[model samples]
Structure formats: structure tokens, C-alpha cells
Target: MATAGGGNAHMVFRRYLDAVGLQGLASAEAAGLHTSEWYALSLITLEGSLSSGELASRTGLTTGATTRLIDRLERAGYARRAADPHDRRRVI
Candidate 1:
């Protein structure tokens, strides 16, 4: 017996996800960054500067990955690590 499930549903869901992911990637490239770097930057830019640990928490990225992303941003001259006037030991 054939099931009554919808065949096109999966295609529609996948298309939606792909479309959103591609759009985000395109936006990242246009902003002078690798698509993989976009989420970190977007979080920082929208939420204001944050310590690497805090950024990692907000982005669901590990500390090391967040650090690497920050390094790339610095190397690209898109961002820089600054001393938090109140806490000279931390990069802001």
C-alpha cells in the first residue's frame, strides 16, 4: 500500500534551507569575508565588541575557532583586538 505522505515536502524544505544558507554566504563574500567567518563577525558587529570567550558563547563556536576567526579578521584589517580600557589583559 502507498503512503499518503507528501513527496514535494522534503524538496521544499531543502530548497528553503539552501536558499537561506546561500544568501548568507553571498552576503559574507560581499562583506569581504569567507562565508565561514560571517557568523562570528555578524554577532560581534550587531552585538558590539566582546571578548573571545563571550563571542564564542554567543555564536555557538568553540573558543579556538572564535580565536581563529578573530585572527583572520585582524589579518584582513576588518577588525582588531583592542585592550579593554578597564582590563588590559583582555582583547576586546
Candidate 2:
């Protein structure tokens, strides 16, 4: 059971999430991208840079799906993959 204050907080958080989702949808549409692409872009922007594997984990997408997502983002000029500075074998 939640206290009244806790319930209000939950409502506020839910509203915030809804607002963010709406904004994200609008942004994605403006950018000519799918919602998932926008989400991946958001994650990348938040992290500054991350590996595709890390992105997959964060997005709850499989490696192949994440790869495809990255492909679309790259094609749309929203993101780029580069070799990690210290690890040539890893991409960022």
C-alpha cells in the first residue's frame, strides 16, 4: 500500500514519463526516425558514447536488432560508430 504522498509522487512520475514519451515521439517524427531509433539516440546522447552491445542491453533489444537500429541511425545521420580510443577491437 502507498501513502497519499507516495501515490501523488507516482502520478507525477507517470505524467512526466508520458510527457517525455510524447516529446520523444514528436522529436523522432521530426527527425524522420522510428521510436526505437529515437530511444537509441537518446541513450547514446545520455551516455555520450556507448558500444552497440551496451546499447542493446540498455534498449532491451537483441544484438541483431540493435545493429539494425544503429544502421538506421547512421543512415539518418543521427549517430556514428567509431573505434574505441583504447580498444581497437571495440566500437563506440
| lDDT (tens digit, per residue) of candidate 2 on 1-92 | 55466677789998999999899999999989989988899899888889999999999999999999999899878899899999999999
Name the top lDDT candidate.
2
For model 1, what is the alpha-carbon lDDT of residue 57? 89
How well is each residue in 1-92 modelled by candidate 1, as lDDT tens digits?
55366668966887899999999999998988887688887777898889999988887889998899889998988778889999899889
Off by over 4 Å in 1: 1-18
Ten-residue stretch with the least lDDT total in model 2: 1-10
Give the C-alpha lDDT of model 2.
0.91
Q: List the residue pairs that clash in candidate 1.
A: none
